[model samples]
Target chain A: MSLVEALRVSVTALATHKLRSLLTVLGIVIGISSVVSLMSIGQGSQERVLSRITAMGTNLLYVRPGASSEGRVRGAQGGAASLTLEDATALADPVNVPSVAAVAPQVQTFAQVVAAGQNVNTQIIGVTPDYQYVRNSPVADGDFISDRDVEARSMVVVLGATVADNLFQGGSPLGESVKINNRQFRVVGVLKRMGGTGFGLQDDVVLAPITTVQSRIMAQRTAQGGRTVSSINVQLAKGAKTEQATGEIAAILRQRHRLTGSDDFTITSQEETIAAQKEVTGTFTTFLGIIAGISLLVAGIGIMNIMLVSVAERTREIGIRKAVGAKRRDILMQFLMEATVLSLFGGGVGLLGGWGVSRFISGRTFSGQVLYTVVPPHILILAVAVAVATGLFFGIYPAARAARLNPIAALRYE
Target chain B: MITFSNVVKVYKMGSIEVPVLRGVSCTISKGEMVAIMGPSGSGKSTLMNIMGCLDQPTSGTYQLEGQEITRLKDDDLAGIRNKKIGFVFQTFNLLPWASALGNVELPLIYGGGVQRRRRALEALERVGVAHRARHRPSEISGGEQQRVAIARALVNNPSLILADEPTGNLDSRSSEEIVAIFRGLNREEGITIVLVTHERSIAENARRILHFRDGLFEGEEVMA
Candidate 1:
């Protein structure tokens, strides 16, 4: 028989038992829809993370103290107070690090702040004026900390968007005095909300001048009487290679720290951080894909089960066809086509359903964040292909059994 | 034309051989209406199955239209069945899900033809069931269902039509009508017809009747 005729026969057979066919197809539909939606969610989250990282500026690098690992044991990241303000000064000079554009040294400590009766514990970061451009943070209102603020050790502060909202309740806190660690500081600026990143929400910090934070809020001094800073954010010059710049910065820090065997600091570029984050999200996507694959597998077994039952139930019909001169291949193709048609129909419906689900739930706020789902065309194609393959793989045994049936015995079957 | 020599069908039920057709030899020429009459356990059904190519004989030299059929492959036998033999069952084995015309088209489907619908309608017309062509077997009467089965058997224009108790499930009126259709087909189209029935009246309608007893042919009679 021709393929078209075979397909028609299968469709007719399935149509006769609509409920049975639908139930069988339901398993495949659920399996395929879940796979598509879950994969899209995974891809969407990964894209979101990568885009956020790229938005932070690709030419940026972070220089922080302490190696991730010590000689025999692992140490907390950025725990050692090895980076100092002098290191930032050395990096800013073109003579010490040629690819370096500007350096913003920061010292961070958590402190309780009070403003008019509202009290909130928030991260206090002491940063130089170059931090606004280096970290891609710009004040949304009022003026940012000026260079004179750092030189005079002025007790002026800038609040992040979240901090400002919580402390002043949507009211402008500009020129208002807030106490940080019981030290009075004037709120000079409010930073724009930059959303969340791998480091948590950027809109929940407090910024002040580096000198003021070192002397008044928290003090950590090295043996040489130099002020210690937590990390140094370095912006590389445009057109400078990130790999070469990272090597240059690591070499400079090693020379300044005077360690021969290994540097007591870590230099991380934006590309490396993005790659590491990608690995994490990639693993999460793969894990979800595996779970989806298991459902598809179960659906495939359901297909096999239904096909076997169909073959057995139609033994007499098979006998009639065989008696009318159907070849074994004809019988096999007819039954196999039935299974494939079921899954193909289910896959088509499931693709649409999954797309609908993705659209419906996409941009839905969960815990104050909008979740996204992205379904690529290749994933759709792969999903349909997998559905068809599942049908074929599971249909073979039942079709073979039907094809091998003895005509006389099948005719005599009740 | 059909020929069988020393045809023996031994069905082994797990190491115990139950012989059905033992050393039975027969010849059926072109354009003959023959009946094989036997009671239950007399192996008439088994003989019909072998002649229909639905089962192979244990030891035999069977020839159909001068081709060596006993040694032919399963697929080759199926090809022969498609092109040269048609079967009508006792229960009027029309697909309940299919319309009368669709049932008639089944044989031509396996026979590979582009004019399936036209030929199937023609076959249904020949059996006087063309008006019921669109009706499923379940929606039609027993006589009409049997006629549809006959149309299915005749659609491929086979050299032989083998009927196993074709009217066993029909009333006397329907049985007579089915037998008359067979008679008309044999006389008008000169097609070979072989039927298995235990009813003497049905057997007598054929031009010749072969009596089977205990897996062997006992006697034969030619009618006027």
Candidate 2:
């Protein structure tokens, strides 16, 4: 029989048992749908990470003290106290590092902040006056710390938007005094509302001049002779390669610390770490997609089982067609086509279902940022291809069995 | 043209052989109308199966239009059955799910083409049941069902027609109409026909009659 005729017959056969055909392909639908949805979620999360990296500034780098090799293993936060305010000042000099732009040294510590009878625990950041330009945070009301404040060690502070809201109830605290670590400081400014990078929240901290934080509050918390700062944030000049700046920064830090064997600091580009993390998430998503495809395999078996049953049920029909001069391949084609069509139908429905559900889930928001689900077009094509291949793989045995039935015996079958 | 030489058919039943045909030899020329009459278990149906290439003989030399078909492959035999022979079964074996026109189009479908429906309608018209072409087999009477089967058999324009009790399930009135149609096809279309029936009255409708007993031909009589 021609393919058109065979397909027509298969459609008719399936139409006769509509419920059975639908149930037979249900496993495929669920499998494909899960594969699509999980991949979408994975892609969307990867985008979230990428956006976070770019949002912080693609040309930015951070230098932190490496963990003290004296005994224990620690991350950059617990590293050696080799990074200092002098290293930040040295990098800022254009003669030493031409790629250097504005550099901001931070001495970060968590503290309980109180203002207007309201109390909130927040990070207390000690920064130089260049922090406004280097970190992309500027004052929204009043003024940030002046050069005179850091020069004379004035007890003045700037509150991030969230810290200002919690401690002052969204009112202006320009001329008020807030206590950090039980020490009174004058509020000079409130920073604008800013989003956090993947590292930490930007709008939940208090800022003060470097001299005041180091000499007075958090003075006991300072590690290694009280001269160490936590980290140095470096902003690259326009059109400067990060690779060139990284080498120059490392050279200057090693010279300043007088280390001949190994430097006690590590300079890392935020983009590099973000790229590595994105690769890991991509691999994890691919693994999940494969695991979800196991259901399609089970669905293939379902198709085979149903095809066998159909072959037995239509034994006499096979006999009649054979007696009318149908070759064995004709019978085989009829059954295989039926299975392929069934699976393709299931795949089409699954793609639509997965797309709809993903869109719905992505439309919701948790805190502020919108959670996203992305379904690329190629995923749809892959899902359908897998479905068709599954049908063909599972269809072979049943089609062969039907094609090999003896016409005389099959016709005799009631 | 057809010839059967020392034909034998033995079915194996797990170490035991059930012989259904025993050394039967016969010949019927082209355009001849022959009836095979035998009681149940007398090899009448087996003979029809062998003649239509549905089953192979155990030890025999059979030739249909000089093809030496006794040893043909299954697919080759299917081709011969498709192009050279038509079959009408005792049960009026029309596909109950299809309309009469659909039933008639089956052979042409297997034959492959776009002209199947048109040719099937023509065959139905030839069988005098074109008025019931759109009705399913279950919706029509047994006689019309049988006529649809006959149309299906003739749709391929085969050289031979083998009817196994085509009138067995019909009433006397319907049986008369079917027998008349068969005689007319033989006389006017010059189509060779071999019919198997237990009823002697049905056998008398043929031009020649052969009697079978105990898996062997007992006698033959020439009819007008």
Candidate 3:
């Protein structure tokens, strides 16, 4: 028989028992819809994480102290205090690092602060004035520290938004003296609020001039009259490739550190961080997809069960068709067609259902970022392909059973 | 034309073998209307099944239009049945879910005919059930259902028709009408026909009647 006629016959047979057919299709619909929505949600979360990482700055690279290893026992990252303020100065020079735009060196420690009976222990960051622009933070009220403040070792300080709120309780703290480590320093400015999770703690810091922080707060210095810093934040020039700049910075650090087999610092670019996050979310998406695939397998078994029942219930009809000269191939095609139609129809509806579900879940705010589900074209194609394949895979046995029946015996079936 | 030469059919039930057709031989020419009459368990149905190519004989040869059918494969037999034979059952055997027109179109669908609806409608017209074509078997009377079955049988325009107890469930009036239609197909269309029935009055409608007893042909009577 022609395929079109066989399909018509299958459709008519299914139409005879409408409720039964729909119940059979429901399993597949649920399976495919879950797969689509879960995968899209997973992709959405991955996008959210990558966007958060890039929000800090794409062209900026962070240089931190590398792990210090002593005869196979390795200390944690940032344990080695090998980086110094002179290295930050060298990175800021355009002739030494051509792709360098600006550099800010930081020396940070947790310290207790007191102001008018209010005392809070918080992070104290020592940075050059260029930090205001390099870290993309600007003062909301009062002026930031001047470049001359670092040279003069001035005791001027800037409060983060959270510190300003805690110390003054919504009152202006500019020109007010706050004591850190039993030494008085006047607050000159308050940093703007940087709202986000994971990095939102940036709003709870106190900033001071690097020279003043080294001389008064922590009185620590490297041998040979050099000054130590915790980390250096380097901003790359526009149109500069991160890999090239990273290589150039590594070469300069290796030369300055002198006789180094390995560099004592680590350079991390924004793309690398995003790539690491994508790997995590990709595995999560695959895991969710595998879980959803189990339901599709169950749905396939359901199709097989329904197809078998249909073949048994229509044995007499099969006998009639066989008696009228239907070959085994014709009989097989008819039953197989019925199963494929059921699954494909279910898949089409399920795609729409899943899309609706994802859209409903989209635009929800989580941790200060808008979450959105992404349904790529390949996902839709893969879903439908799997549905059709499930039908065919589970359909073969029942269709073969129907096709192999003896016409006389089937005619005699009650 | 049809011919059978000492054909034997033995059915195996588990470990035991029971012979249903024991060396039966018969021949019916084109345009002849024949009937095989026997009581239950007398092998008349078995003989009809072999004649319809629904079962193969254990031994001996049967020829339809000079082709050796006993050795043909299942698919080849299906092809022969599709192109050269039709069947009518006593229960009407109409697909209960389909309209009379759809039932008539079934054989043409299997035969891969393109002009199926037109041919099915024509077949329904030939059986005088054209007005009832839109009704399903459940909606139609027993006589109309049987007519629809006959229309399905005639839709393929096979050279031979096989009827198995074609009127066993019908009233006398419907049975007579069915027999009249078979007689008309034989005389007017020159199509060969073979029917299985136990009623002597039903057997009398055929041009010849073959009596079956205990898996063998007992005798034959020619009608005037």
Candidate 4:
């Protein structure tokens, strides 16, 4: 029979049993929906991570003290006090590294910040004026810590947005005195509400001058009788060659630390770390997409089962058709058409369902916002291809059965 | 033309073999209207099945239109059946769900992209059931359903028509009407017809009669 005739017959057969056909195709629908939705979500998360990393300044780099190989400080037994405030000052000197924009030494300590009996455990960050530009910290309410604040060792701190909210109950925290480890420090400014970072919430801490933090709070001591800084935040000049800047910065750090082959400080660029994070996220999404594809296999099995049953049920009809002059290929094509139609219908419904689910989820949560942004078109096409392939693969057995039917016996069959 | 040479059909019940057609041999020429008459269990239906290519002889040479069809593959035999033969069953084996027009169109559909509706309507018109084409098999009388089946058989315009117990379930009036239609088709179109029946009156309408006693043709008589 011609393909048009075969399609007509198969469609008529399916229309005759609409409920059964619909129920059978539902399996494929669920399978395709799960695959498309999961892939969209994975793609969305990948984009989210990439965008978040890019948002933390393009030319920013970090220098931390001591090689903690295997989580053990290389030099000191307990904790390595390798980086010092003098090393940061040496790197900041334009004569040594003119490509450097700003270099800020930081010392972090956990302390209970108290204001009007409300106490919250928050990180106390010691930074200079340059820290704001390096970290992309925006002030939402009051001014950021200035150069004067760092020079005079001002007994003042800037509250991160969340810390301001927690300590003063949403009131203005600037000019209010908040005790850090029982030492009263007047609030100099309130920082903006920076969203979450890879490490934690960006707005969940208080900022202070590096001099005040080292001399008054924490009071951490090193055996060398030198003030210690945990890490140095470095910002490179716009359009400066990264390789040249790294080389110059390394020379300055080497001279300041008086080190040779084995350096105590680790200098890493934000770009390199972000690239690594993107690679990991990309791999994770691909793995998730593969796992979701398995459900499509199960759906294909369901289609195969239904097609086999349809062949069996329509044996007499097949016989009559063959007896009346239907070629074997005709019968085969008829069954194959029916199976393909079922799968295509299922795929269409699945696409709609997947899109609906993705849209709904994206409207509800923060992660969903990222998901909505990264809709993968290839995944949709793959889903449809899987559905069509399922039809072809599963339709074979039933089509063979129909094709191999003996015309005479089928006619003789009661 | 149909020819059977020492045809053998055996049935196995456990290990014992019961032969249905034991080396039966027969021949019928083109354009001949013949009926095979016998008592029940006389192997007449077995002969009809072999002649219709519904069953191959276990060990024998059968030829249709001078072609040795005995050793032909199932698909090759199906091709011959489709191109040359039409069948009308005793139960009127019309697809119950299809309308009279749909049942008649089935053969044309299987014939691969002919003017299905026109051929179907013409077949129904020939069977004198054109007005009842929209009625399903169950909605029509038994005689009407038989006419629909005959329309289905004739729609493909096969050269040979096989009718097995065509009037076995019909009343006398309906039986006469069906026999008249068969006689007219055979005489007017010169199409060869093979019928299987035990009724003497039905056997009398054929041009020749072959009688089966045990598992072979025992006697023959010229009827017209």
Candidate 5:
């Protein structure tokens, strides 16, 4: 018999048991939707992180306290005050490290700022004047902290977009005074609105003079009399190799610190940070795919189970067809094609549903910027291929059993 | 013409070898209407199965219209059944999901043709069930279902028609109606018909009859 004829017969057979066929298809629907939704969300977050990393100026390295432990444990840095102001000064010496073009040391602590009876708990960043150039972000309003403000220890602050929005209620706060933890500070500037990254929400911080933050709002207090900075932003000179400077900075810091078994700090550039984040997101995406794949397997099992039952129930019908000149392949094709159609239909619906759901949720961000969950064409193809392959893999044994049925015995089956 | 020499069918039921048709032989010429009769488990159904190409005989030579069919491959036997033989079961055996026209189109589909609807409708008309061609088997009467089954059987224009207790599932009135149709098909169309039944009244409708007991054919009688 022709394949077209077999497909028609299978469609008719499935139509007769419409509810059963739909129920069988539901398992695959749930499985494929999970895979599609998870993959798109993972891709969306990856793209967001990538853009944020690029937004932070290229060829800039961050020298933060605490070293990463090798092997099993993945630990977060910036836990220790091992980064001292002298280390930043030593790295800024052009005679010792000629590859360095600029350096911006920062100290940050969460502080409650009250302005015009409105209050907000936000990060207060203490940075040098070069932070505007190194971080590639300029103040949107008024003047930024200058060398005079740092030397004078003036209690002046530049608010992030969110902090300013919360404190000023949309009114101009350029010349306003806001209290930082019961201490008065004048608002000198407001940063432009940059979108939030998954980590280190740069648009939500309040910047102040470093000397002011060091003496005032410290999240961590030190017992030693020496001053400690949180981290230093080091920029490479134009056309200089980052790898060579990284080695030079490591050596300089090691010799300055006097003695070290493992270096007490970690230095990372934009590329290294992006690669690590990509690795983490890659592992997360793989984990999501595996979990979703298990459901597809379970759906396949459901298909096989239903197919076997169908074969058993249609024993007499198969026998009748065989007696009417249907070959083993005809019977086999009828059942196998039925399975393929079912799963493909389910997978198609699942793809659309997953896309709709992801798009719907992505629109709900507080920042109001649209984050699209990217569904690649290859993933669409892979989903369809997997559904078709699942049908073929699970449909074979039941179809073969139907094909091998003895016509005489099958006709006799009630 | 149909021919079989020393055809035997032995079935192994678990450890015991239960012999069904032991060295039986017979022949029925073309355009003849014949009936096979025996008690239950006497191998009448087994003989009919072999004649219909649904089962292979253990050791025998059976020829259908001068072609050797006894040892042919399973698929080849199916092809023979598609083009050369028509089969009717006692239960009618119509696919429940299909209409009468769809059921009648099965053999013609296997026989390879795109002119399905016209041919299927013509077959249904020939069996006097054309008016109900769109009805499912359960939606029709028992006699009408039997007629549809007959149409499905003859749709491919087979050289031989094998009916295994075709009227066994019907009431007396339906049984008589089905037998009359078979008799007319044989007399008017010159189609060869073979029937297996235990009922004496059903056997008497054929032109010739073969009596058997315990897998052995005793004798044959010509109906007047």
Candidate 6:
């Protein structure tokens, strides 16, 4: 029989029993939709992480005070000490390491800010004049801290956009005074609103000089220094070798701390931080995909069950066709076509359903600007191919049964 | 023309071997309207199945139109059945889901022609049911359904028309109408016909009759 005629027959059969056909195809629909939606969410999350990481300067590096004890015990012998301001001074002295640009020593603490009876909890960061350049922090209102501010141990601050909004009610906060735990500090600048970086809201912060925050605010003490800094930000000189600059900085910090074998500090580049984040997100998405795959397997089994039923119901029809001159191959083709059409229709509906679900979830979870990434063309094609393949795989036994039927007995069947 | 020499058909049920046709030999010439009459379990249906290419005798040399059909493979036999034989069944056997036209068109679907719709319509017209082409089998009366079945048989233009109790389910008037249609096809179109029936009145219309008993032909008769 011609393929067109075969297709027409299959469609007619399905149309005759609309409810049964739909129920049979529902398995395929669920399988395809689960796979598509899960993959879309995975892709969307990955893109979100990538864009956030890229927004932080590609060349930026962070040097922490202690080594990453990812696999080490808490009481291990190589555990490092807290970093200090003296180490930052040594790294910033370009005479010893010409390949190094600006170095900003940082100290962080959570504090409550109060202005005109309005209060909000915010992160306080202590840094130097070049912190903006190295960290790619853009100030929207007033200027950032100056060299004189650090030299004089000034109690002035720069508020991130979120902090400024919370404290000043959308009014300019620069040159105004805000109390941090009842200690008054003048606002020198207001940072631009940087949206969430997937870690948290980047705009909810206050910045001050390292010396001012150390001596006047946190007063966190180190064993050998006036005060301690949590981390140090470093920028490499243009066209300078990164390995050489790292080595110089490490050697300088080791000398300043008088350490041997195990160093008292850790140095990380932006690449390392981005890689770590990607590893976490990749693992999370992989776990989700595997869970979704189980649903697809169940759907495949459903297709098999329905196809077998169809073959049984059409046993006599198959025999009649054979008796009227249809080849075994022709019988096989007809049954297989029926199965494939069911699955393909199901997959088509599933694709649309998955897309709609993704859109709904994205809208509910994030700003409407957030969109779930669509499954690529290749993935959609793979889904359709899998659906068709499921039909062929499950339709085989029934087709064989039909072909093997005895024409005389089948005709006599009541 | 069909020739069957020393044909035997045996059925196996567990340890027992039930022979349906025991060494039957027969020759039927072109344009002959033959009837095979038999008591129940006399192997008449078995003979009809072998003749229609729906079954093969256990041991036989059966030739149809110069081809040794007993030796042919299943697919080759099916091809011969498509080209040379048309079947009218006792039950009318029209697909329940199909319209009258669709049922007639089924044979042509497997026959693979360019104008299946036109041929199917012409066949329905030939059976005198062209007006009910769109009516499904369930919607039509038993007589009309048999006419539709006959249209399906005639659509492929097979040389031999095999009717297995074609009028068994119809009223007397409808049965007379069916027998008249068969006689017209055989006499006017020179089509060969073989009918199986238990009714003596139906058998009387055939030009030749073969009577069967206990899996063998017991007698033969020719009518004027």
Question: Which residue pairs collide in model 2, if any?
Answer: A66-A79, A66-A80, A67-A79
Query: Which of 2 and 6 is the better model by TM-score?
Result: 6
- Pick the winner on TM-score between candidates 2 and 4: 2
Model 6: per-residue Cα lDDT over A64-97, one tens digit each: 8774354555444223346778778888899877
lDDT of 5 by residue, A153-183 (tens): 8999999888899988999899899998789
Going through the candidates in order, their DockQ values are 0.82, 0.69, 0.75, 0.49, 0.74, 0.68
TM-score of chain A of each: 0.91, 0.85, 0.80, 0.87, 0.83, 0.86
DockQ of 6: 0.68
What fraction of native interface contacts does model 5 preserve?
0.77
Models ranked on lDDT: 1, 3, 5, 2, 4, 6
True-structure RMSD for candidate 3: 4.0
In candidate 2, what are the lDDT values of residues A1-414, reduced to their tens digit? 778888998888788789989997787788778778878877777776677666555578899887776555554544566777778889999999999887998888888988888999888899998888877778899899888998898999999988888887868889899998788999999988776432554688889998788888755332445467888889998899989999999999888777788668888887777879789879967877877777777788888998899899889888988888888988899889988888898888888887877888895776876667889889889988988888889988999999999988888889
Model 2's number of clashes is 3
What is each candidate's fraction of native interface contacts (fnat)? Answer: 0.81, 0.64, 0.77, 0.62, 0.77, 0.62
lDDT of 5 by residue, B173-213 (tens): 99998999899989998899999987999999998999988
lDDT of 1 by residue, A335-394 (tens): 999999999998988888888888887889879777788998998999999999999999
TM-score winner among the candidates? 1
**What is the DockQ of the complex in model 5?**
0.74
Query: Which one is best on lDDT?
Result: 1
Q: Record all residue pairs in model 4 with backbone atoms less than 3 Å apart, i.e. clashing.
A: none
Residue runs of model 4 more than 4 Å from their true location after superposition: A67-79, A89-105, A155-158, A167-177, A182-201, A221-226, A234-255, A267-294, A363-375, A412-414, B5-25, B39-43, B54-61, B66-72, B213-215
In candidate 2, position A117 carries an lDDT of: 85
What digit string (tens of lDDT, one per residue) describes model 3 on residues A223-318?
445777888988899999899999999989989888358778899886787788999999999998999899999999999999999899999999
On the 0 to 100 scale, the lDDT of residue B209 in model 1 is 96
Alpha-carbon shift of residue A110 in model 4 (angstroms): 2.5
- Cα lDDT for residue A124, candidate 1: 93
Lowest lDDT 10-mer window, candidate 2 chain B? B106-115
